[model samples]
Target: MWPYVAGFIGGLLAAGMAAAGESYWRRRRRTKWIPQELQRFFRVKDSSRLQVLQKSFPRHMAPDAKRGLDQWLAEQGLAARLVGVPITESFINTTGLSALMAPQGESWYQVSSVEYESFDVGGDAPMECPKHALWLLDGGDAKLALFWTYGTHRVGCNWVERLRIEAGFVMDSPGSGLADQVLARLEEAVHSGHAYRGQVLSLGGEDDYRGNASGVTVHRLRPVARQEIILPEPTLALLERNVVRFAEQRPRLRKFGMSTRKGLLFYGPPGTGKTHSIHYLINVLQGHTTLLITAEQIGSITEYMTLARLLEPCLVVIEDVDLIARRRDESGVGEQCLLNRLLNEMDGLRPDSAITFVLTTNRPDALEAALAARPGRIDQAIEFPLPDAAGREQLIKLYASGASIAPEVVASAVRQTEAVSASFIKELMRRAVQFHLECRPDAESAIILQNDVDQAIEEMLWSGGPLNRALLGAGEGREQP
Candidate 1:
């Protein structure tokens, strides 16, 4: 019985050791086989070894880069030979003893590539991709081979799609010049602003802004006209002169020794027309790109600045800026660092760069002194105060332009809405229109009478309680200043 037990234990130990050895060798062979297969498939000659250049990009931008590079190669009259290699679950699972002992004809690289249609959220388009592809281009004097693969990148617990590109050339070719030309073309294709024009880009990512491609969500913005924004004449004039004029006459400003990059601060209560005014600006500057960064995305402020520089004549809007630009000493180290980055980026802008930094905050006192107190950083600080009687009247009429409200009703509502914001007036007009619609649903030409306006004003201002006033952006009329 003792001999039988000893023999059984020995057999178990041997089996475990054999399995471990087989596993190690399988992984080793699997890793070595792919590169060997790539070399053989390309028929890389003994006299000419492969020189490789590699780059990685967010999966979203990879297709664009590949297409751009392919187009560029075709334009240069280079013939492209494409070979795709499939990576299947069976291949991955068999990456042990089975892989090592597999015949050359049965290798993973020999498998025919599978193509799939990938949906792009950026636009209404579907792109095609294989699991992995190698592109060979004949550059007359030099032969270039490009390889691209798609994979998942784990960022913390989140998985992000990533694309890796590797380019190989003959060792005897003009390596530096050829590589630079290819890389320069790729860079231009990747950074081209054609894709982001007339769209609002919000910063994305956990800690850093990865520029337009990797860390951004493109928003299609609806253009607002000048008449839609109600502000004091002087404030409108200031915005036109400082922001609009700066963008329009950037070259002229640079020629005159004036800095083309201007920073404008909009400080006021929540319900004022600060953001509305920004929308108007966005509309007027139709050709230029606009970047909208919320307080939560302030961590990517530096990245936003970099993009602004690249996309010149760009508007960088930072809403609720006081969240990140708090006084240095009173804030945490991270907040202070963010404030410093903001100042540095603003200061580092070239005079000829037509980049406008538009920052808005309800609390100006909470901002860092270096940002607001400095002269060069903030070129203009425009206060967006609550609309006075005249402004409110104009806002009511403007918002009620399509409605059947009379001028007298608007005038009456304006008189009662003192210290209310342009937003409040707009909401009042909206409620009045709704009331009229409810009372006379079948009346296509129903008029919004003074009684409707009066009822809306009373419900929003007097009877609906403090919460209603706050919700409609009426209670906070005065700026802290």
Candidate 2:
């Protein structure tokens, strides 16, 4: 009984709507409301009547089209004027790529049909269509489509149905595979150390993530990891011992005052591959989060305290502590404050806290005496002195073993250099090989010649000796000026 009653009601409602629509259509069809331009294009032949009716029609029909067109039409005394000039300009630019206007005796005819267009507005610039300009079609409508191109190009036209395009021309659609790609790309950027300055995941409004290529580069204050970079079997074994001890024993050792927090201070000559070793550590310690901070980042001692305290459960690296942690009296009051702040933060972290602080310095002696005195403050101080022959050979292998350098040349260069850090040796090899290659671009591609290595060594012996001497002197001295 109820089902029949519901069906009867629905049928009556449908019939009433149909009757109303039919009546409205009949009335509208009989009404004399033809547009002048349309009538002219159709060749209605009643030009005088249309002109009279058009002249009487209000001048402000298309608000966005009227400004420029109204002026033109007013100047020409057209039968009807178009409004909304900016909107119309955008409409024409987007839809027709170029709108065609034909003189209809008393009015201008718009020949093209309306089309949707969109522009991706994030990143450095907006996405573009060659012939079409994307426009805002729905002034009052919430959901808007954007796309514009000259009418002939059909390829980009179909993409207008997608909701939005994220950075790098990626389109996003609901329940679609492409949307997943966009989200995954964003997640990769975030996880791979790209810091989000803005809400990047949300696509509701215009703003997207804009930041440095690798998020924030905290000026690493310490060696984020051990910097005594050596490929020697003995050195590797020693490092492995420490790493194994830390990984395996750290958990049990925590109760006996041994901390899960590890600190390695690399005190050695410049060019000892201290920086390179840190990079290697960052690469190896994949599971753990790391933050690199330098002394230069400590604007005032106060800011250092704040940053260090905040970025906990992370590796805080101080790159050159010989410059930053110098004795307070040896430098300015500002330097003293910075050293103090660093000291406080280093001492402040709890024993079991996840944060690991690594400080690197060429001159450990120049550091404030008391800074290193705090027990458990600096758990281990590993030194990276000038590399021995074996270390040099390993470094040469690492640096020049890339597909570009010839293996024979790498061996010859490694053997010739004396007592230089891995860094200096690599620099020499890089410069010498580059010079040799550039000098003989058309020559057979092969190992860097022994002659090239000798020349580089000679150049460094004469021209570079002074720089090294100066650095050695500064390392031993009170301060670097």
Candidate 3:
């Protein structure tokens, strides 16, 4: 009976040991799985012989970079496929994206991402992009592995915590130099492939204002017609010749060894058509990408210029430039630094680059003398002065919503708006129409009477007070300030 019991215990112990050994062996096989697959795919004896090269980009641009890489690869007639490497959006190995594909030296595998990080990148729908992914790619004689990770981030944080887009290429170690070549092309693609190209965009989001690092927001501006801008004939022609005409003559200018890049200053009081004229230029330069940088965003001018180069035939609108253009000596450290950067970028542009810098400011007297004296920085400074009686008449007629205003009535309103802005007249016409419609809603093309125009002007100039007058673009409103 004792011998029988001992035999049974020994058998049980052997079985348990055998099971444990098998489990360990399976775990080891699973660990080697990805490396073995990569080795076989590259037709190399060892995984160490494979080289992994990578590039990092701003996190906000990760999705764009991925799109660029894919677009560039597709253009090269190559596609990447998975080789059983796992993926997850939240998981990131400190070494690199290689951990998801073929870890460089020491690593583990994490997998399965059914979700994508997506958002509107100048499109109606959000752009869907992989948060983490690995792929095996073959381009004729070149065999490579591609790894991408959205990288890690902490909310409201800077780039310190790996806030970037990591893209890597793994290939044979002898160095076919293929990775470097592909990376160069990929970098260009990332820049040119930006979805914001040929679209109206502005930098926003981050308080730090680190160029593209801050983030991009798209804006939709309805097309403004050539007839819509209300500047005087001389001012209008000068603007068209400097901006639209210059663009058309880019090739000829470059051929003649002249610079295609230009900087124009639009100086005037508020609502005198500086911004309105820019919108017209945008419509005229149909193929150009427009970037609007407010005074607060001036810090990112350098990055904006880099983008302008990539998306050439670009219109860069800088509003209230006088804020930075104040005499540098009188300026604080931060202000002086920004003004220097702005000047440097404007001067740094290539002669043949097709970028037009249009800067707007209300106080030309407050502008830095250096900025005005700088030759290339202000190729032309067009004034956006308050309209005279003739220009005012045109503005009133234009904004009247096709209402038949008696010639006498228009003449009266134009005289009253002598020193007011094109924008003020635009609002005056709107209020006049509202008054007409309120009393005559059923009438088509209601006649705008003198009373209607006068009442609207009273409401804008008197009822709304000084703040409202300024808000409506009224310049002093017949009062000396």
Candidate 4:
């Protein structure tokens, strides 16, 4: 009886140990789960949370973090606004904060705080005290802030403790570098210290400004292929500079108005890649989203201004702003308040915020003086004129090289053709491709012949009064020239 009792006890102990081992393995596997944005934000080299947080060291750390977080929230369709100045509508307390929901129809959520005692990776034992207090708000999505200082500054609270309080569950003393990273991201986000006014619309029609244009047709601009864009030396240089600006802007991308956004005015003849270039710029600028608006969307200056201020770090592309905001070649239209709103939106009081304005028109002289006078209103007034001889050659090469056209013959055809915009050339090439596909094996190779290109050009030149009249004549025939 004694031996039987002992055997049963030993068996029970062994079973308990086996169960404990399985539990440990299961916990390890579950801990490996990581959110996609978090993985991208930290560039997680290891599974440890400390290791992941430490690795996110982009130059503009704060903005980068905000962007990462914003993107995740946007994917979830949550509205996130970077609250700058404290607004009467945005309430706060010792534990959390809240803001008035924008774009309407969205409900508000309570802000809460969490204390993470060991988020830091190095130095003695990680600070066990509450490191920071975070403010979480719904902006079409969740936007969380780990602040640096919130309460009683005069007291003998160590800067490290303050940092911890600000950073929430993160490191206490993130140092200037880490602090800057976090601050840069939250620059546009409102805190208790800043001042804010009741947001008003400076421009936009009532329906759109009121967020009621559900079925409105928006001009969703698409980018021309890289091969199709003939980058002249000066334009190429500008493109490179824009790319650098975007790269430097990575961290501050979430912060509205950190650096003045550069707006390019593409004005010239129609089908000159003006619209297409806008899309190209968008593609080059990573993490940048383009919002295309027409004059119809903005009925007044007040509505437009309201939209611009409310939406930061957005590209407001106003196609034919000259129609509404321009001085108006036709007299009575000059007194338009819409122009005032656009000018203010572009070069208004809040120049430091993160909203960019892009306008394109065939006649730039039509724009109002007040609108263009603003120092940074039109950072780079690029004119997308008709392609020159060299530009034409490049266009031909881009269009025909994909096909089996003879290089020398294609070059000759390009030289023979009159000056045309990149858009026209693109149309010509597209037709060539279409014809080639239609006549595939029945016609020799799957290549567009020089003759086919020539025919396409001839058809374009003769089909319209403008192209035919212009090509037949010479001297000052081109608009820009």
What lDDT would each prediction earn against the true structure? Answer: 0.71, 0.47, 0.74, 0.48
- Each model's TM-score, in the order given? 0.77, 0.49, 0.78, 0.49
Sort every candidate by lDDT, greatest first: 3, 1, 4, 2
Query: What C-alpha lDDT does candidate 3 achieve relative to the native structure?
Result: 0.74
**Per-residue C-alpha lDDT of model 1 across residues 1-481, encoded as one tens digit per residue:** 9999999999999999999999988976665444455455445523135566777665555545756776677666767667555555322121221222235524445424445434232465434544476665666675666666666666554555666666666666754355667767777766775455455666564332322234456665677888777788999899899888767788877889977778889999888988888988988986777899887666666667766776677999998999888887678898887777777788888877788899999999988888899898888999998888888877877888677777787778877787777778888888888888889888767577988988888888768677778877786443321
RMSD of candidates 1 onward, in order: 7.6, 22.6, 6.4, 17.8
Q: Which is superior by lDDT, 1 or 3?
A: 3
For candidate 3, the per-residue lDDT at 240 reads 89
Model 4 worst lDDT window (10 residues): 192-201
Between candidates 1 and 2, the lDDT winner? 1
How well does candidate 1 score on lDDT at residue 304? Answer: 77
RMSD in angstroms between candidate 1 and the native structure over all alpha carbons? 7.6
Error of 4 at 43 (Å): 53
Winner by TM-score between candidate 3 and candidate 2: 3
Candidate with the larger TM-score of 1 and 4: 1
Q: How far off is residue 15 in model 2, in Å?
A: 56
Stretches of candidate 4 off by over 4 Å are 1-228, 239-261, 300-311, 434-445, 467-481
